[model samples]
Target: MMEEILYLGNIIFFIFLWRIILQVLLSVIQIFLKKDRSSTGDEYHRLYEESIEWMRQESRKSHRR
Candidate 1:
């Protein structure tokens, strides 16, 4: 029983170590392949402007009613 427990502990340790290594590798890859910020930024700016225009139209509609 004790031997089995030790073997299980070793297996768990290896799995944990592997996960940490994999995470580090993926983070490094991500640093090199990150998306362009300017395009996303432009999309957000366009959405914001559209939202503001929609709100203004809604306000005008309410005033006319």
Candidate 2:
């Protein structure tokens, strides 16, 4: 029974370690894929404005009696 418990502990430790390593690797890859913000800032702002306008319209519709 003791041996089984030790083996299970080792397995869990390695699985957790593997998850941490994978997350670090994915974060590094995302950094490479991310875009520079200088060119796209205006487009992002426009989309944000449209989203806020849509939300206001929806709230106004819901508040009507």
Candidate 3:
């Protein structure tokens, strides 16, 4: 019946709404508690150094031009 279909739709909607709320809350908590670990990694450090070297080279080239 139409009423049963409406009830099922409401149930599905509420379940979806609850999932979204929980995801938001958990993400907020993680943002407050989490620190970025990439900067601490060796790969990140190497990349940062490479970027700095590239910038210095570019500046030198621009100064010569």
Estimate the TM-score of every prediction. Answer: 0.50, 0.52, 0.52
- Of candidate 2, the 10-residue stretch with the lowest lDDT total is 31-40
Off by over 4 Å in 3: 35-65
What are the clashing pairs of model 2? none
- lDDT of prediction 1: 0.92
Q: 1-65 in candidate 1: lDDT tens per residue? A: 99999999999999999999999999987776555566677899999999999999999999999
The collision pairs in model 1 are: none
1-65, model 3: which lDDT tens digit per residue?
99999999999999999999999999988876555554457678898899999999999999999
| Residue range 1-65, candidate 2, lDDT tens digits | 99999999999999999999999999987776565454477789999999999999999999995
Best-fitting candidate, scored by lDDT: 1
Model 2 spans with C-alpha error above 4 angstroms = 35-65
**Model 3 steric clash pairs:** none
lDDT of 3 at 41: 75
| Local lDDT at 19 for model 2 | 100
Q: Note the Cα lDDT for every prediction shown.
A: 0.92, 0.89, 0.89
Q: Quote the lDDT for 52 in model 2.
A: 100
